[model samples]
Target: MAKEVSCPNCGKPVEWSEQSQWRPFCSERCRLIDLGEWLNESHRIADPTDAPSEDPPPSDDLSTPH
Candidate 1:
């Protein structure tokens, strides 16, 4: 027997097998919904930690000729 997994979008039970076209998502609607969320920036991956940077700006000597 194949193991079952829940759909990420609608929380529906999905079979983890070759027969399941949408393995993570239950249906096309759910898949599209998830895509829309990503496109709209509703879903984001969190960073491990926030660090401040103190890098200096690049010199503009190359842009100006003597």
Candidate 2:
């Protein structure tokens, strides 16, 4: 028996096989929906660093004669 995985978009059972074109997604509609979400910033990777520092470090060029 082949292993199955739930579709990320619709939670449908999908066979993890070569015949499964979308693999993790059930169909093209589900795949496109997921793509749209990513494009719209609905999904984002968490950043480990803190928010950007307001004050930037002093540049070496500023100290040199220009």
Winner by TM-score: 2
lDDT of each model, Cα atoms only?
A: 0.80, 0.82
Give one digit per residue, the lDDT tens place, for model 1 in 21-59: 988888889989888988756334443234456667666
Tens digit of per-residue lDDT, candidate 2, span 7-63: 999899999898999988988899999989887663344443444657766677667
Stretches > 4 Å off in candidate 1: 42-66
- lDDT against true structure, model 2: 0.82
| TM per prediction | 0.59, 0.60
Q: What is the lDDT of residue 21 in candidate 1?
A: 91
In order, how many clashes per candidate?
0, 0
- Residue 32, candidate 2: Cα error in Å is 0.7
**Location of the lowest summed lDDT over 10 successive residues in candidate 1:** 42-51
